[model samples]
Target: MKFKNHILVGVLLMVNVFVFAQYGKQKKADILFNKFSFVKAANEYRELIENNYNKDYATRRLADCYAYLRDPRNAARYYKKAVEQVNVPIEYYYSYAQALRGIKDYKNSRIWLERFKDSGGVINANDFEKDVNFITSVFNAKQQYFLDKVRFNSKFSDFGAFEQNGKIYFASSRDEGVSVKRLYGWNEQPFLDVYVADVGTKRNVDHTAKLKGDVNSIYHDGPVTITKDGNTMYFSRNNIDEHGLSKDKKGISNMKIYRATLRDSIWTDIEDLSINHSEYSTQHPALNKDDSKLYFSSDWPGGFGGSDIYVVDIKADGTLGVPTNLGNVVNTKKSEGFPFINNEGTLFFSSDGHPGLGLLDIFGTIQGENDEFVDVINLGIPINSNKDDFSFSMNPNGITGYFASNRTGGRGDDDIYAYHRVPTLQVEGIVSDAINTKPIANSIITLFNDKEEQIAYMVTDENGFYQINIDRNQDYKIVGSQIKYIDDYRTFTSKYLQTELTTITANLLLNPVQDVIKLAELNTIYFDYDKHNIRKDAALELDKIVSLMQNDYPDMVIRIESHTDSRGELSYNDKLSIDRANSTYEYLISKGINPSRITEHEGFGERRLTNGCEDGAKCEEKDHQLNRRTQFIVVKME
Candidate 1:
């Protein structure tokens, strides 16, 4: 009996030691997993499972590690083993359901999801409803129709898409018959060129050719963006000079960023971007939806690892500020790149080290103040695959996503694919005047989504045309107004509509009002040098005048009087002032004001004076411009 007892005690001690060792390994794996060191964590978990200690716990954790690594095939297999064990935790059911979802087994996923709900778990029903809604939408006929219509034929790897002014700009590596292939490090495909496609017909892209001129060079140039006016382009290019040229005579070395101007519908000379350099690679530029800020990926010094996301302010003059790291919340000690920030402040990025579905998967988080990021979530399954997936772009509405993926069925090493958020509705329309059958220009239109929040605002163009984009799942109240015109409000709700382009026209008729007529309250108007031509600033102010006249005194007729300083010859200055007043008069008439409602103009040359100025006065040019002005005086209150 004593001999047996000794042997048993020795066996217990060995078992305890083995268990402790396994526990330490599991703890280490958990730590790395939390920090988004997914590859390392997966390896650690795999070692624990191989040791065969606490098989249930080790298998479960290993499955989670594989999920983070974006290896759903392995993740699902191990998760199956974990769920087969007796008395599994409720959280394990949720995990298994996610694995099933990642593998596109929605029916089985629903089974596990329902089991989780029945196990006295307090799940957020709204989130489950959203997932279900999205899945149902994806399985719908319309989604399949769109998928069938869009072809994936390409000659090179393409990505980093952006849409502006009904045109799509993206990066590609296709050969343009250039002799030497651009090379970056060991990667032979360093030649990235920017290409543009017009969405003129809405159904297809007009890829008639690459963007006009030096836009497509022999260097790696991509991730292009344009301001709201479409005059200036901000793009990333690699190579030679501080002006974005290849230093090598061959024009195919190094990488940097540059800016170019668009004149006469063609890209002119290019200037090097002042913010980046060859010492550290900076690529994948994304402008904020408002074009107020710029985000990009950089492998510069002081970063967490291989690369990280950085941002800079876009000055009004188109200059970029000093780049600032996005901090640890959005970045890790591993590779973090391909960042995209939407209009709603939601950030999407691709990371190799984060807990995801595969080698590199896309992730999303909400940006917080003080350069913080929170609520990190993995974009699972179809959106993220087991292969390298990066370079994603989304429409302002966030309903559509375009990304580059090397997944099984593609045209080349990488191809562009577009995915639409399931169950989305669209809000679109045109803005016009009430009285005349004419479009309005410079009219501000605001759209408020179902959450009673402003989602988008657009101005009517010279043709009085505007389109407001909205998510399909919600209701919206749209309001359109212009200064001097009555505000027009309308409400509409959308259902399941899969049309590529939905057209909704909301015409507004603003009746003229006759109440308050306050003049002299206007600020001084500005004019061009040596001419009475109305400047843009002057037109903006005159818009206010039109608004007041239409809304406050619709039937009132007015006389526009032009004035000039005492410097110029009397007749010349008088004629200049008269022309200036007539210019304002013509603009109002073009904007739908009745000609009879505006009386004739008078040029009070040097007669009217706020400041006594004889010939050769030492007044500033600003003051003199102010003296050469136009005024609208009420002629008759109809």
Candidate 2:
């Protein structure tokens, strides 16, 4: 069992040239597998396994075939058997772990990943382990896309959509009824060809035909990008010429990027880029906003992964510069390809290396402070699935685009989907007091759409934090309110959301009610010397409390505390303070203030004196008067 057989299994499906066994049947199946014909090769290997002819080799080849077919369930099943055999190669442990991930069996995936690491297999195991919660995070993320299957999708693979000058160019394996039919060995479908369609509106496919002239080849071709003027095109094709495919020393024909000129509505002047090499593949060309740079994916040497995205300078003379790999920020230890650059200079690509929903999810880049791409963010759900998703291209408007996926519920093995971005606008922040800056827990935050109708509302947590998702391109108003504070109003619109998900910080500062009992600056209510009755001046102060509770804060609940001067005995002072508290409570009740509004009315006696008027202390008359005072505490304000 060779380790090379387990790596680089698709696109440029490189396999070790060694014969699995000396038997004729094993040799035939090995040739089929090497030709990227996993469908036929799987059948052959399955038959050999049934007959018990070199069962070990047949079983291993069968697992590799299913893995190429993107059937992870069957792949995991066979890989389990292969790894359980004697003298199992180290690659099977890693491959089996990946297969388990494809089926979302993360617990078992981690087990195999640890085994692979323990066996000294330096692969994506470390990264895979760190992404243990990746699936959960992807599913829980805000939905960023609404997808629909394009009408032009066929029973075969239809994908790679690029928009140019009101026309849509894509790659498809649909049989076009050509008298001489050619089929790709990979899935028995017709060889992929570039097709053009007059798409007047988004996702509308009418008037379709093959691209004119030398662009479409008998071998795989297309998934093309055109210049702004639509006169120049760049596309991917097999590394072949007029004679035959140019094979490397290992007998493998890799992919290459070609440039063509459109003359008189016919494409011609096809020239292979100088950067292409026979040993590796460079495909999926995407130009920047100004066309000064071209980005593509390749499995060229010195890359960080099986395939990595690279860029080259496009000179005025229509030639290319030296290729530079996008560093670890964009490229990982696993395969990444299908680069697309939007007008905003944001790079989008597909990757199995990054944490995503499952195998090969689309990811976007976040730039650092130095204007270099740093963080890679998964595009998340709908746009990604538990299967291969790639070839993401956006239209000039930047809101609508197309990508390909082999996930379930598609029209074919690989279907092209037209997606309109549903801009995710998240309003989040803390609701705090304007004066104290303390979190106003249990504050109500309400969201209203453009029509002024309340869409949703939520209560802030103990930390006074809240978050809400709003629709794109719509005006919204978020209001925060608490019982004791005035409403905080904020209005914004999502019409200019630049990213797939835009987060707006709407930290609210609520103003506390000026005369609320909690913060009210009132003169202390005093009493005559050692008297248990409310004084005339004290009645005036108590009336203020009554008016605030009755007219302004009708739902105010309060607690009253009264104290006595320290000149009297402790027991006598305690009784006098109690009488004063009752008198004040009765006064508020006589003014029609609700009795239940006073949750607690108790005398603290001389314990909580406002002045230094303790017993046996020398104090002025005013000092003792300050000690014999009643204070109001606002308990709840609705």
Candidate 3:
């Protein structure tokens, strides 16, 4: 995500176009827009729109303003009007899709996405359809994080939160000195500086205060990384030295990473890293857990993209070795940088080149079994957006982490967000035979979702203990069945607790079946969405159950109970459910199970819901599907 601020001479050219031809609010707004003062530009454009002046330009500028500001809902609204009035840019379709995604209008996002691709879009549309499918699953497949805005965030660009020992360090561009104001050419805001805060007695951090003296420099200072011992540091700064600001051939000052040592709590002896050069840029340094290697982003020559992550070995004598690119798998033809590696050797970074839900999505890669890094996966939605998200960091505890985003609903242009992963619900206990009260080894423990569809399967350990992961505020059923024992069923719904993680112990004791093992706690039959026809997979399961009953318990009786979820009218559901039950009975008779032996079959309709997902109660498909099911019971003994 690009910040709406002046960064280069190109922006002055954009400003000149607006200044030369236009006047009044439109031109004034354009001036701010060229300078990347989106907040002010949005205000001016909104004023013109309210007064019904320059409708086309006003609407377009407003849309651009909100889009740059990461307010997608507003961007989508204005873009709609702009498109209706004048020609909509092809990139607007991509922006529209991102806005729709941010507000969760995924289906519409797809529609606009197709329009984007059809409008001659290229360079970043690879794997578009595949990513859309993956996104849908991610939206409903249980979120890994719950996020909240951090406390010390200024109304400016505040990000890069890192912690060590009892001190939390970060970078912020809050106001420094108005008397001798200095603004970054790119964003026109105060330059960044590394700040320190004390780790709180209860919370992770307390209050933020800027670094003193040498640590705070005349130029853009920080976004720092420190060694484990905390006496050494690496930070980003402008291209400058004793002779003054260093410039490349184009007269553009580049960024460089500097190393400093902590002497008596003061940072001194600052020197440029060996990788720094006046010819190209290198910044954003991260040290490994053992400090054996230093990784940083560079836009040097021979790189695959404008910027790529490179690593250099930290020699035993505390000097840097030659730099090496992270390779093509992690880098792309487009920019990829801001890398942070956790203790597990997983590399997390932000990139726009990879096909994603939106701009600069955060991605993670783990050390492959046979490779250095592989399995790069997008950290979809909430954690990422169409906006830029970078400078990712994770604490030592692993349950919580921090990152920076320019996405909507933040306190600044770029704000830091604190995220916590939901702890897994572990279902673990012993399984045993009911009559013998002895551990049943190798029993099958199948975990089913609210829809009574199996999601995971496990075998009992030597102690007959079975364990599986589950979720809170959700329904799950666990079934245990040994080779000779009748399957026993236990259903539970986990709840929120004080601790971050929770466990449920369910000791399942299966009943022995000598002659006829009546179908108990087993509901394998399934139907299409609201249809009564049995599917091939359902038939496969039913065929096995029928074959077992006909061969072993020819004289036994069986019962079929069919049910439907609480949707549509009650009368319609009742008829549909009864038809499902009759369909099951007919299918069983087709398999040669005597109709006389199966004397019981009925439809429950929606009279009894497994949960309170009845009509008028808001629910998702999974919750409502829980009520639609089939179960079996023994009616007569052999």
Please give the RMSD to the true structure for each candidate, in Å: 27.7, 22.9, 24.9
- Candidate 1 lDDT, 310-422, residue by residue in tens: 99998888788888898886788899888887655567889997776688888766332332564356666677788988887776654665777888887767777777655
Question: TM-score rank, highest first?
Answer: 3, 2, 1
Better of 2 and 3 by lDDT: 2
Question: Which regions of candidate 3 are displaced past 4 Å?
Answer: 1-142, 176-179, 199-208, 432-438, 442-463, 473-638
Q: Estimate TM-scores for all models.
A: 0.45, 0.49, 0.53
Task: Assess the local accuracy of residue 608 in candidate 3 as a C-alpha lDDT between 0 and 100.
Answer: 70
What's the lDDT of the predicted structure labeled candidate 1? 0.66
lDDT of 2 by residue, 1-638 (tens): 01221221221122111112323455567555543345677888998777655566578778876665556788889989989975566778877777788788989988987898899877542656564333233223346578864787777888889987778899988866667778877778888899898774435342248898889888889789988878889999999977877888898888999999999999999998999998898899999888889999999888998999999999999889999988998999999999999876778999999888889999876553344664566777788999999999987666788999999988878898889865445677778766435567789999998889998878875556666666667898999998778899899887876754446778899976655343464456888888978888888888888877788779776768898889878998888988888888788888998765675668888898776667788999988878888888765565
lDDT of 3 by residue, 65-175 (tens): 665555567777977776564345566676666666656777987887788788886424453443343222222244666786577777778877888897777888886
- Candidate lDDT (C-alpha), each: 0.66, 0.77, 0.72
Local lDDT at 481 for model 1: 82
Model 2 scores a C-alpha lDDT of: 0.77
Best by TM-score: 3
Winning model by lDDT: 2
